[model samples]
Target: MMSCSNERQIITNAGFLAVVASQATAGFLSAIFSIIVLRKCGNLHVHQNCKILIVSMVMLYIVHSVSITILQTTQLIRYLTYYDPCVVGLSTVICFCLRLPASVCTTSFASLLFAIVFERATALWKRGKYDAYGPQLGYALVTISIIVSLASTFWAVQKVEFDQHSVYCSTATSQTADRVMLLCFLISGVNIITLVGIIALFIFNEFALSRREFDLQSSYQLRENAYVIRIMLPLSIFQAICYAIFSISSGLISLFRDKLSPVQHKTLYTTAY
Candidate 1:
């Protein structure tokens, strides 16, 4: 048997371990799915520009997932060794440099997911000439998404200055926690909207549009665009679920913050991150 403090320490360690495991699993799965999509996009029969948009979104998500896993793993190790598990031990410079990439990529991923659905909608609507002019629009959307995502996270980055005197470094800190929560909420809303809209579009096109007669070539193109949208539907739903989970977890952390022990708060915050 152990004392109460010892038992608490064990639980804390377990929580950190769980966060690490989940991050690792998420990174691995994202990598696998991204690779498969990259290989199969040529067969999707959508415009080449649409395919470019899809590939860009996947690349963003894969980098986001991998960077998040790496950051959280370091957080776990730092939490275990540091006196204050609620805060990180890395210097402000190192932490900012390490965390900035993941933060930027994650925001870009969410923004780009919305962009992908919007592009597909346009491509479907302008099926006749989309293949010719769509690439420029695709490139433009990608640029806009990166700019928007970076702007969204710029507020958080301002908090990432070097402070040697008793400075704490994780996103778990208040300086960043609010911004993170807001971003999660945005991601969750974006994903849910896209998921519902994608499903509705798919059903309408498959049943309503398919029932009508059209020229052979035009009908075939319509069906191919539908196929592209159909394949992306699952991905949209997956993103919705993942972001919803993160948002809910972050909400729970806020609701129970004052009531929770430092260990519990840290665990929840780190997990949500």
Candidate 2:
């Protein structure tokens, strides 16, 4: 017969193992999907510029997914060793490993989504002249995203702390950290709005294009652009929805900081995940 403490330890180990296994599975599936998209983009009969942007997005997604999985795996090891499970309470090295990449990945994803919106919008509005500047624009956006996301990462890592009784690491303990979380919520709101607006614009453009007549070559080009957008729109929408849920939850957590128990905070954070 197991003692009480032993039973509790068993439960904790099982929970941590479940989390680690799920994270690993998610990362594997995401990598597989990204690889397929990468290869398919190469073979796609789409504009070269669109292809470049799509492939780049896939690459970023892959990197983000893999980084998150690694972070989770690190947490799993920490639990196995009976170290602090909360990221905030961990040593600086573990803290950096867990938070920095996550911050950068989150911000970069939002930026890349906006960049895609720009590319698709330009293609729809400008029609034929898109290839002239699309790839250049995408590259510039990606570079800028990396820089901005790094800045956000720095801001988010400011005073992370861990509580043994708490559900996870707490970053909103200080006023500055609270402000940083608020900023994240604001950015998330922007992502949702921009994504929704992009979808609306795409629908309008497609309808307008359908009513117009063009030369066979121009029409073919338009169709190709539309095809690319159509294939990518669902992905954009899925990301936007996830972002919306995360952002709204973060905002609520930030707003009701004093009211939420650690378990509530953990639940919200998990939902965001």
Candidate 3:
């Protein structure tokens, strides 16, 4: 004997609960996988680096998933007439908590990928000199990544203002946010190009190394490097595409905010989450 509004409210609550539960589960699983990778790959230097990268990616995804869940749940509650300003406020806070860490982790991952590429290039092209500068390059790349990520965080916070009335939780005024989103898309495109270029170089170096009278171990290592490049290249490309799509969609939403109807707003917010 429930009323129509009551039924809609029940459905909204159920949907929101489901999203939050899924997010929590995903975060838990990611944490467990990160721990396992760290434990199993602790001894080998190469594997240790790989583990660090994997852990960083998992943590980033965990933050994203949790943020989406909070946003969705908050929207659902708001829609179901159980809206509380404080709940909305908390959701915004949680969204930001995830955003900053995710950005930093992504930057760190890109730097790691760049370092690995440089190391491989050095080993193949300047074998005798690699040991002299490989560690130094790695250290420099990681440090630079940290600094860049911090700078980006400061810029985003300063330039973007959170929209309290909008369902989506983000920093930046609508117009400025659109520009920032475009910049992110451009960055992703550049990343994809860089990854592809590195992969091409890797393949060429592998071919050259194979035909030379190099040490057997060196040849084997070159092949391994080629394999890693193959895997990472595709992954990087996929991530770039994902980032581009997200950025473009966000930019469009921000640009058309005033023209969108309530249903359109809800749909867009849901898609974003």
Q: What local lDDT does model 1 show for residue 166?
A: 15
Candidate 1 vs 2: which has more TM-score: 1
How many residue pairs clash in all the candidates, one count each?
0, 1, 2
**What RMSD does each model have against the real structure?**
4.6, 5.2, 5.7
Residue 98 in model 2: lDDT: 59
TM-score of each: 0.80, 0.76, 0.70
Question: What is the number of residue pairs that collide in model 3?
Answer: 2
lDDT of 2 by residue, 1-273 (tens): 224343234325554457555776787788788788777776888766566666767787788777767766665565566633333234544555555666677777777667766766666676656545546766776777678777776676655443222223233444345656665776677577666867776676678577777655456656775776677567667777877676677777667856964444444554456
Q: What is the Cα-based lDDT of residue 191 in candidate 1? A: 81
Candidate number with greatest lDDT: 1
Q: Pairs clashing in candidate 2?
A: 89-162
The full ranking of all candidates by TM-score, starting with the best, is 1, 2, 3
lDDT of 2: 0.62
Candidate 1: lDDT of 210? 59
159-250 per-residue lDDT for model 3 (tens digits):
44444333334444343464456456656665676677677777686677667877665665566566657766776777667666767777
